[model samples]
Each structure stands twice: as C-alpha cells, then as structure tokens.
Target: MDMTPLLLAEIQFLASFSFLALFMALALALSWMLLFFKLRVRLTGDAGWTAAYRFWVRIFALCFALALAACLPVLAQLGSLWGGLMDKIGNVAGPLLGYAVLSVFVLKSCFLGVMLFGQRRVSDTVHTLSVFMVALGLLLATAWMAAVHSWMQTPDGVAMVDGRYQVYDWFQVIFNPSFGWSLSLTVLGAALAASFLIMGVTALQALRRPPGDGERCAFKTALIVAVLASLLQALAASGMGDVISRYQPVKAATLAGYWHSGDEPELILLGWPDAATQTNRVLLAIHDTGGRWLGHDSKGYLGLDKFTGPRPPVALSFWLLRVSALLALMMSVASVLTLMRTLRRRMDLAALGLFWRKVLVGMSFSGSLLVVLGWCVSLVGLLPYAVNRSINLSDVFSQATSSTLLLSIAGYTALYVVLIAAFLGMLLHAVRYGVVPVRKTTGGAA
Candidate 1:
C-alpha cells in the first residue's frame, strides 16, 4: 500500500537512518579492512587484499557520496516546507556538499588509478595515502551533514526577520545546541563500527583457517581493538545523554519515557511501544536519572514549548531509546566475547562462533532499526521548533503530483534495497573468496 504524508515522513526518517547505517557499516568495514591489510603486510611482507579492499571501499564511499547528493534536494524541500532555522544548513549545505562530492570522487579516482597501475612497492604507499585522504574526506562530510541534521533537534540563535530568518553568527549556526557532543558521538559510533567489522573478519578468518599461533594472535589483537572502540562509543553516547534530555527532552523522554519534567529521570528497559495509546509496557526502569546528563537540564524539558498540542506522546521516545540502547549493548557484549575467545586460543570456538552468528543476525536487524530511529528523531525533532516559524502559503512541492511522489518513493525504495542486497552479497562473497582475489592481479582491479 502507498504511504500517507505522515507515513511517508516516517519512512523518510527511516530511510535516512537506513542510509546512515549502511554508509557507516560500509565505512567501518572499509576502514578496518585497510588496517588489517596494513598490519598483515607489515608483519608478513604481503600486500594481500589491499587492492580488492580499495576497490570495494571506493564503490562504497561513492554510494554515500551520491546519497548525500540526493539529500540536497530533500533537505531543500524540507526547508521550504518548514522555513525558519530549518533552512539555515540547507542554504549553506549546497556548496559545501558539492565540494565534498567532488572531493570524494577525486579521491576515489586517485586511489583506483594507483591501485590498478602503480608498481608493487609504490602501490602500497600510494594506496595507503589515498585511503587516508578518503578517511579525512569522510570525517569532514559526516561532521558537516551531522551538524545540519542535529541542528533540527535543538535549533539555536536564529532570529526571525519579517517572515524570514537572519542568521546572526556563522559559528553558532554550525555549532548549534548539541553540536559538540552529537558530532563526537557520531564519530565514535563510526569508529566502533569500523573496529567491529575488522574484528568480525578476523574472527571469521580464524574460524575457517586452522588455528596457528600467528593467526590466533592476530585475531586476539583485532578483537581487543574492536572491544575498545565499542566501549568508547558507549561512553560517548552516555556523555551526550544530557544533550538528548535537555535539548531534546522529547527524544530523551521518547528514549527513556520520563514523565513530568524533574530532577531525576529513570531509564526504561524493554517495552511494547503503543505510541497511539501513549502507554509503554515498562519492563524495567533505572532510578535517579539526574540533571543534564550531557548539558541541558530541567530547562531542556522546557524546549518542548515549541510543540503545538499536548506535545508528542512520551511513549514514542520511550520505546526508541530502549531499543537503540539494547542493540548497542548487545553488540558490545558480542565484541568482548569474541576478544576473549580469540585470546585463549583453546580452539573451543563454539561460544565465539555463536557470538559471530548473533552479530550477523543483529547487523541485519540494525539496518531497519537505525533507519526508523533516524527518521523519528529527525522529523519529530523538527516539528517543535518549526511550529514557531512563519507559515508558507503553498505546499513545498506543488508542481509534483501524487503519481510523481509515488514514483519517487518507489524508485528510492528499490534502489536502496538493491544497494543493500549488493553490499551484503559482496560481504558474503568476501567470506567465501577471502580478501585476496584468487586470480592473479588483473587490469580490472580498478
């Protein structure tokens, strides 16, 4: 069935999250793959899969690059529809986005060319430099886009001027309210994802190949790195709890379901989300959640003033927070377990194997969950602030028909599904074929 406007908005939120997760997963996999290749080469004096890794990495990076390009139009339309501070980033984002896309493409071309044609010794060095360049580009692009997105949750320092907005400070625009913590959390999350993939591959390799001392040590190291990265990511998210609560109480409350703003909020565990009925089947609630876990406080609850009627039901935020947190924690445990198993080198691989199996399953589920979370947070986060803005007379896309909208929606759905399928297919192929191409290096390496 075709989705309604509300449903479509939800889907857009879900789609953005889905895209972000895919982008992050691909990026994480690519980063650790490079690191693994580097370590192996340094230790054993073999470039191994560096060439194939670059090929896949470039393809993956290009996908996100294009996805960001596509978001430009979507953000523009959203800005026109919402107006006010909503458009601030979109206005500035166009040129910045253009520069980013061109930069990524250029980096990809440089890496692809070097990997394909450069001599053995030079190729490794050139490939390493190219990958570093791409990493830098990704860091910048993710930060910029995240700033634009997180701004929607806690808009600040924007003044209305005769039905238009006059942004007073450029730094403030970029900084927004939750700028620092949000950016940090995203970067940490990306790093965690990268480490997880690396260790995951390491673990898989160890399982398939007979246990040798060298292989066991390598697996242990990868798992430790992944575990460390995952822990830091959790801490980063926790550090931002105050920001989510104060600047985004609805999100906080939705995440944890704390009612009637006060000194301490309890954290909820598992629950069925009946947002329509405004009731969460609370499985567990922690005690004494206090002021400004990230920054904002009781005043953060006040930010809900931007909403029109009764505010969004608290249940929505309640369920989302619990689910996202649970998945993150489960993944963390799996990483730690993998690390422990690899270290013992006892060859009793059943436990670690189960953990890897869970991860693969969890990874599949996380795709949709993250998509839903992204959409919910982005869309609902905007409503409170936009309600205070001047109204536009016509709908943003008046020229577009229902048919056009459907076609647009359907096309995106198909493309992303195919993109996801292709990515998973490649991942499984890597498992089957290993990182080093079985065939001798060919001209088509690019």
Candidate 2:
C-alpha cells in the first residue's frame, strides 16, 4: 500500500499569504536604498545630509525587523506543511535556500544592525556603506528567490534520478530564462510599493496639518519616484505578457478569457469570463491586434481551447489580471498628475490644493494592491503543476490527514491572525509616535 499526495487549496492559499508578508518586507527593504540615494543627492548642502539620513534610517530598521519576523514561519512551512514536496525536492531546494539564507540574510541583518546602532559608534562613511550593503543584500535575496520560483515553473537543469528530481547543473537552475525578467519585475514592483507607502504616510501627516518643508520634500520625492516606476511598469507589462504568450500560451489565453483559436484575434479588454459556459461576455476589446501585441504573426499563437489538460479556474485569473493592470495604469496617471502639481508649486504643500491631497491619501495603497494582484495572477496562473510538466500538484501536495489538516489550519490561522495584528499594530504605533527630529550635526555626524 502506498500513500498519495493530496492537493489542498487551503494549504496553497495559506502559503501564498505567508509569501505576501515576506514580499511586503522585501519591497520596503529594497526601496530604502533608492530613498537614501535619492535624498542624499537631492538634499544638497547638508554635509552628506546626516540629519535627513538619521530620520530615514530609523524607519528602515523598523521595516527590516518586521520583514525578518514575517519570513520565519514561511521557511518553517516548507518542512511542516508541504512535507510531501519537501521529501522529494528537499535535496535540491535545500542547498539553494541555505546558501541564500547564509549569504543574503546574514549580510543584510548584520549591516542593518550597523545602520541602526552604529550611527554614532561607526563613522558616517561606514554607516552609508552599510545602507548600500543592506540594499544589495535585498536585491540578491530577491534574485535567489526568483530563481527558485522560475526553476519551479520551468523545471530545467534537473533530471529524474531514482524517482526523484535532482539538480545536474547548479548554475543552470539559478540562471533560467525567466530569471532576469522576473527579477526586473520584482524590483520595479517593490519600488512602486515602497514609494506609494512612503507617500501615503507623508500625505497622512500633511492632512493632519499644513506640511512643513520636510513633509513637502518627502511627498515630492515619493510621487516622482512612484510615477517613474509606474511608467517603467507599464513598459515592462507588455514584454512580460509577450513572454507568457510565447512560452506559456495557456496562461496568456486564460488571462484574456481567450478560448478559441483564430487569425487576427481581438484582445479582450473587458469581459466576464464564464468558465462553465466556456465563453466570455464582453464590454470592450481591441480589434485584430493579437499578432502585433503578442508577437510577430500572433495569428500563429495558441489558445486555451487548444490546451488538453487539467487547468486552474479561468475566471479568477482573468479578473485578477484585469484588475491589477487597470489599477496600475490608474495609479501611473494619478502619480504623473501629482508630480506635475508638486513641481508647479515649487515643492510646497501649502500651494497644493485640497482635492489632490484627498486623492493622494486614497491612492496611497495603490502600489501595494498592485503587488498583491500581480502575485495572484502569476501564482494562480501557474496552477496544477508544482514543477511545470514534471511534478503535478496532485503528486507534490501534502498528504496530511483530515484531522491533522483541521488542527493545522486552526493553529496556523490563529498564528497568522496574531502575527498580522502585531505587525500592523507595531507599524501604526511607529507611524503615530516614531518621529525622529533632525538635528544639525556639529561635524557631519548623524
């Protein structure tokens, strides 16, 4: 008698939420370097801007701590929850994961300590260097994680040995075709999320009272960076879609509720996908642009109707993609308009009107929402296959019993609720109380 792996939707959703928390921290950590470097150059004539640097460093430390805490459970889930997948692929993923933890996390946490505590102890030069190091660590860590996911999706550079997937080329596993584009999108998404969050915080402050020069400066910086990131995201979105259309046409077709194959197919812009009926009712669509949009001679491209396999829910993925893309574009437009207004006012919030202030407050979470949406589109889109063509979800999922799963779900749910509450509570408390006053340095000290 042999036990079989059982795919649990609940477990998958839980794992996704765990990753969401980790990514939120990653975005904050990655964005700190941009904020620091940008502020350093823009806030000229302050002898390395020591006053401003100190203010941002405290905020960075708080975010770093939260991110570190959120990631612990996600790592534990690999062994405890998804034991079946780990039993098979642990020999391969374990080493890659260990290297990332040892190299990236250690480097980041060590430097983060220096940035937080060594401001007065170490020289300003060392502290500034630590900031850059922490940022580098974040990027590298993100890259490693992306590589792991990419390998999972494509499953190249591995061979089946004695009924198990084994890595033959370590370099190939980390350098998959999707690695570069995935990392780029992740970085840009982080920038977008971090920028909006900072802007939102400052905007909330502005609403409480007329913004001071520092507040105005922060708003301007965040808005400008966010707008730039949005533009880049727009530029990257098409290329990413094209890659999916070419490499994973099933996902591309599902994204647009595209079912039947046709020449010069229209791109469905707005529609309600009815998976049961295998049809979509449309309100808007582009005409005869599939070939031009997806690739050269897009008429030659495949469709979801042609795919013969067990697939994920279609309506959910389609709606998610539409919402995420639309929200992203809307934010881009809003950011650009806000940037123009800030520039016209000479970076003074007093000159900024009330209407835009309200709008900014409402739109502060736009980037974070986009981050969550994009993750949904990607992860849900790659369903049924834990390792693309190699490992089906039915073969890689956990084999926990009903009673065990019930207890696990209940326990994890409680734990998740507590962790999320604590994280948000701390963040809110910090925002409400943690105001670092900028003091003029006697001799260029933070």
Best by TM-score: 2
Count of steric clashes across candidates, in order: 9, 1
Runs in model 1 lying further than 4 Å from the true structure: 1-3, 32-36, 39-90, 109-112, 115-123, 156-158, 198-222, 262-265, 272-281, 290-313, 346-407, 435-446
TM-score of each: 0.74, 0.87
Q: Which tens-of-lDDT digit does each residue in 186-263 have in candidate 2?
A: 777877876777677667667777665555555666677787889988777777776776666677777767777776
TM-score of 1: 0.74
Residue 359, candidate 2: C-alpha displacement in angstroms:
1.7
lDDT of each: 0.52, 0.67
The collision pairs in model 1 are 13-375, 14-371, 18-371, 242-293, 242-294, 254-317, 254-318, 255-317, 255-321
